[model samples]
Structures are given as C-alpha cells and as structure tokens.
Target: MADITVKVLEPAVSYDLLTLDELKTILGISTTDTSEDALLEMWIDQYSDVIATMCNRVFAREKVQETWRGDLPPQDCARVFLTHYPVVDADIESVTCNGATITDYEIENRSGKLTLFGSWSEPIVVVYSGGYLLPDEAPAALKTATGILVTGARSEMSRSTISGIKSISHRESRVQFFDESGGSSSGAGAIAAAGDTVNALLYKYMRFYV
Candidate 1:
C-alpha cells in the first residue's frame, strides 16, 4: 500500500465548501451588494483550500484514477483499499489489472475497499469518483467549519467592532466567530485556534496516510 498512488483524472468543478451567497448571508450582508463580493470570494477560495489542507482530504467529489501495487501473494485474492472513500460505486468507470479489465470484484462504498475475486500479481488501476459534491452535498458540520474560517478572515480584514462578540447572527442562522485579538486572526493560526467545535468537526475528516 506504500506504493499506492492516487491521481485526479478530473478535478472537482467547485472546491468551495461555502458559496459566496452563503458567506454573505452568514456575515449578515445583503447578497445583492457587490461591494465586498470580490474580497469575500477570495476568502471563500483561500479558506476552502485551507480547510482541505487541515482535513488532509478533499470534500468535493472528483473523478480520480488510483494505481495500487501488490502487497499480497499472487494467488491470494486480498482486499485492497482506495485512497478516496464513500466511493460512488455506480460511477466506477473501470478496474484494470495489468492492462486487462476485470469485473470479478466487489466494492465497499463507505470503506472504499475492493475485493477482487481473482488473483493478480500486477498492479491494479481503479478509475472512479469519490467524496462529497461540495457546497451542495457537503456535510453541515463541514460547512460550518468553512464559514467559521471565512468569517474569521473577514473579521481580521474589516475594521468593524467585534471585540467581545463570539458569534454573528443573520436571520435564522448563527455562526461562531472568534475575536480578532484572540490570537487567531487568519490562516493556519486560525485553524489551530478554531476551538473545540471546529476541531471536533474537522477531526472525523482528517486523513492519516501511512
């Protein structure tokens, strides 16, 4: 599994966990106002990438091609794992071993494990789409985490007064926001100081590669 390599055959259409309108709505700003839309858009993209970096995984679903090397005996039909999980089983385009396509296999969607019915000495290649669809299908907790980051970035850049305010409320939605002077103004520092809720939300999504 050390030699297993995963490549994005087709990148996701949108990596942003929070849309511009969502960010505006969270900040209690009018969505029709274009004054700070550019800045907010930049934060959305930047903080989205930062969230992905912190999580060590991409939440947006994308088409990927993975090459897995043999770690078991040639005759042993062992179960192998894929890099990206929650695999779109029906969207699995192809599975080939040593240049030959094989269908004698089973895919475990949630675990991203594949159990080949036949034995093979060569490497296996799997082309499939995996992960959440972003903004649209992204989990609520993840969306909240993204909002926190983007809001923190906004707070740091704005000259508005939010000294003791712990959260910002807009309509029926409320987002947790840290004080700018609380030592986590922006960037990775903000992620580190994101407190228990953000940490807990990101914990399950963190990827550990061995």
Candidate 2:
C-alpha cells in the first residue's frame, strides 16, 4: 500500500453528538441554568474529538478528497479504502486515475471500499462524502460513551482537591498508583487513564485500511 493523502472538501458536522440540553440534563443542571452553558459546550467538543481520535473513526458526515498510489489488492481485487466510515451514502463525486477521470467503479459505503473496474495509472484520486449525517444517525453506543465521558469529567471537576490527587494529608502518599497485576486493572479498571468506557464502546467503530 502507498501513502494515502486525504483532504476535507467540507467541514465535518458542526454539532456535537450530545446536544447542550442533553448534556445539561445528564449533569443534573436545571434547564434554566445558562451560567455553565459555554463550559459544557467546550467539554462536549473536546470529548467528541477525543472519541473520534481514540476510535480511529469520524462520527460526523463530511466531504473529502483522497488520493492513493495505484495498487491492487492481493488475489486480484482492485479495491481501496476511503478515509472515513460508515459512509453516509455512496455519493462519489469523481474518480480519477492519474489525471484522467474514470466512471467504472463501485463503492461499499459502510466499509469504505472502492473497487475500480480496470487497471489505471499512478495515483488514484477520489472525492466523496461519508459518515453519519446527523447526530441521531450515530450508533447508540457512541452516544452512551460520550455521556460517560462527560459525566466522569464533571465529577472530576467537582472534586475540591487537585485534579489527580487521591488524598490530601501531611504524610507522603501516592496520588496515582500503578497496578503491576496486569489483569483487568490494566484494562477497563483504569477508567480515568484510558478515558472511562468510551474506548470500549468505540471499538466497533474503528476503521482499518490496507
């Protein structure tokens, strides 16, 4: 596989996976409370980005132009992977081999696979739009993960001690402990270290390319 170059033709969805009202409700804030509106909005954006990064997938729909070095897969399959998925729709704007436009191709939207009919020149370029078009279209697991993260962050903020401090006393005590047990403790048990339950939920959304 050659290096793939991707460019976003349109920005990803501007709205968050969780609406302000939803987040406020989860945080137990009264609907009339506007004081923390801005702060909550910031947290939503930050956590959304974090989830996408960790999952190696984009949650919002957007248009993108991608280019890859021409190469066919093993077993004679002329397929290539697109940047994001599950693709919103198989609405490919254009397909180009080198500089000439080609039309004989098929798209597997959910998997981001593009199968070209015949061999082409050096670089294969494709322009398309993919991903969930609306927040409601996002998988329920993703939304639930976002909620967990937001709730955990809010709880951390309410603590009077320093952010990571486990205890506050005169005697020297470890604020953060590492368990060498290498059991579940190394996994979900380390929620704060690995972003709570979000990563586990995001596993299904992960996208891979060859």
Candidate 3:
C-alpha cells in the first residue's frame, strides 16, 4: 500500500494544551493582573505547535479526512491503521472504498485501527475525528513538558534586552548538540529537551501503519 494523506475537516474546540491559569501556576505567578496574558497566550500557541511537531500528533480533537491509494489489503488482512489515534465512533462520518460507501468496518478508538469485513478496491477514503476529546484527557506529562518549555522561553526573553538585529556578523558558525534521551541543555536546546520529553509521553499514542 502507498502512503496515506490526511486533511483536517473541522478543528477542535481549543488548540491550547494548557490553560492560561495552568500556565500561570506553572510559572509561579499568583497575581490577578492580566498584563502578561497576551504574552502567555502567544507562548501557549508556540509551545503547542512545538509539542505537536515533536510528537507527530495533535493534542486537541479534530475531524480529519484521510486517503489511501495503491493496492488494497489482502484477504488475510482485516485491519488498517488510521492517520491519527484515539478515534471516536460518533466522529467517524464515513468509510468509502473506491467511491463506494462501506458500513461493515469496525473502528478501534484508542488504536485508530479499522477492521474491514472484506477486501475493497484501491483508493480508500476515511473521514473521522481523532485526538483527545477534552483538555482534561490530555496527558499530564505533556502539560508539564509544555510548562518546562515556556519557562525556558520566558527566561531567554528576559535575558535578551535588544530585538531586531540587522546584519550582525559572527566570527564562527554556531554548533549545537541535541540529546535524544532528554538531557540537560540551554536556550533552544533546553526547549528541545522538553520536546523530547513530550514526544516520549506521546509515542504510544501515535498511529503506525504497516
């Protein structure tokens, strides 16, 4: 079989993995001032994208349409993996095989595995929703990882007093090291380490097709 192409139909209710209040608590800010809310919101969006990229998955539930081309599965095979995991039955709009609708397929929500009754033609299409249904369903480890990233980013922002440098020459090219096992690092490296942590937690939830 060929690679599957996925497209988002309807986005989730909330894109933020962590609420503003939760982020404030993580940053140890107890004040009621709303001055930094905008900044924090920006960080939340940035960190959310970073986490999603590292994990190769989305945290918020979203409707998606996926297409698979090439040869269909053999008779011996009964199942195929969806593009995303933690699927919901109600969110599965339809399953089509070569422009023909199919109703006998079984969906395994957590694994995002679809078991078809029989072999179908090529160019299979599936429409469904995937990812955590609610913010509470998001893993705590991921939330904590986001907190770590935001903290490092906030610290870096504080240390940088000047913004927008035009043509500053460097004597030597900068070299950076990354520890895939999530070791200690600094600046962007620190954020990468945090991302590694989040990816590890989300690894099991990712969908892998054979």
Candidate 4:
C-alpha cells in the first residue's frame, strides 16, 4: 500500500481555497520564520495546555458513541469491540493504511518531515462517513482530538471538533481518506448477510449525528 500522507496545502485546481484565518488556525501558528525544530519544541512544550482547551472549547458539542458499551440493534451482540486504545509514538501505532495488520519498528525522527501518526487495531465504521485513523499523535495540543462528533455545519476549518475514531487530516474527502481497509472480513467493516451489520453501524452513526 502507498504510504498515505494527508497534507492540507493550497487548492490544486482551485476548488477549495483556505481563508486567511482558517489557514492560521490550521497552522496553529502566529506567523514566524523560526526553525522547524524550534517550532516543534515549543509545540511539544505547549501540547497539554492546548489539548485541554481544545477538548472543551473546540470539540465542545453534542456527542455519543455506540460500541460494545451500547446495544446492537440487529443481532444484539457487541457491534464493535475496541481491541485496544490506539497509541501514538508507541510500539503499536496505526499506519496510514488503516491498520489491518501489525508490526514493530523503532520510532525514529524522520523529523526532517512534517507528520502526525496514528494506528488502530480494529477498523471502525462511520455512518454517512467512514473509518478514521485515531489522531493519537499531533504536532501540538490544538491538533489533538477526543474522538467525538459535532452537529451542524462543519466547515473545513472547524475540524478538531468534528469527530469519529480520530483522524490526522481534517480536510478529508474521498481522495484524502481512502478506505484502504477494503475486502477485509473484519477490523473496520465486517461482512454480514443482507448488509444488516453495516446498516446497524450506520444507525449508530445517525444517532450520533442527530
């Protein structure tokens, strides 16, 4: 699988152009030409302070989750089970490929690059949406997420608030968020007779959205 890297850059052909404020917000920056390492160090230092404000401010909205904790409408069995909490900068992080398999590698600094990493053991299905890579690791606090959803119009900018299993990219479209978990029996989407199982998951999403 191609190493999928989601970057929020300027519009390619001129469809979506980010506003100044939106770009600033996404940058989480205040206009500076500081060294990348210096910026990263500052961000790492402020990670917690920013994340606290975000969990309450940015993501503050109606939310709910229906996993094994809730009842399944069709079979009444556990709809989805969380194998484990996705870890960041750790042994078991999600690859850009929507982790259906697992492996180990030493975490090294490809620091010469801008990145955010995430990994999930089980693939989660979203309704009117799709699966997401848990945004466990971020460059800064404002970039982190709580895996919750926000109702109403969600613009491209207001992303940390719009939630699911967590994703690194806020500007997610078909091209951006490719369901690489295709043809798998389990993980994110499971096979079911008459598609009831998928429908059931969708139903969970509807409830969350509504």
Candidate that scores best on lDDT:
1
Question: Which of candidates 1 and 3 is the stronger one according to TM-score?
Answer: 1
Q: Across residues 1-210, which tens digit of lDDT does each residue of candidate 4 receive?
A: 111112222211211112223333454545453434353343333432333332221111111221222232233211232111121243222322133432322222221111222343222221111111212222222231211110111222243344333335445542233343444566332122224432332332221210
lDDT of each: 0.78, 0.73, 0.74, 0.26
Local accuracy of candidate 2 as per-residue lDDT tens digits, 9-115: 99775637777888888878997999998888898888877888877767688888988874546534467888766653447889998899988878887788888
Winner by lDDT between candidate 4 and candidate 3: 3
Per-model TM values vs. the true structure: 0.76, 0.76, 0.75, 0.16
Ranking by lDDT: 1, 3, 2, 4
- Ten residues in sequence with the least summed lDDT for candidate 1: 184-193
| Number of colliding residue pairs in model 4 | 4
Worst 10 residues of 4 by lDDT: 144-153
Runs in model 1 deviating more than 4 A are: 70-77, 159-192
Clash counts for all predictions: 0, 1, 0, 4
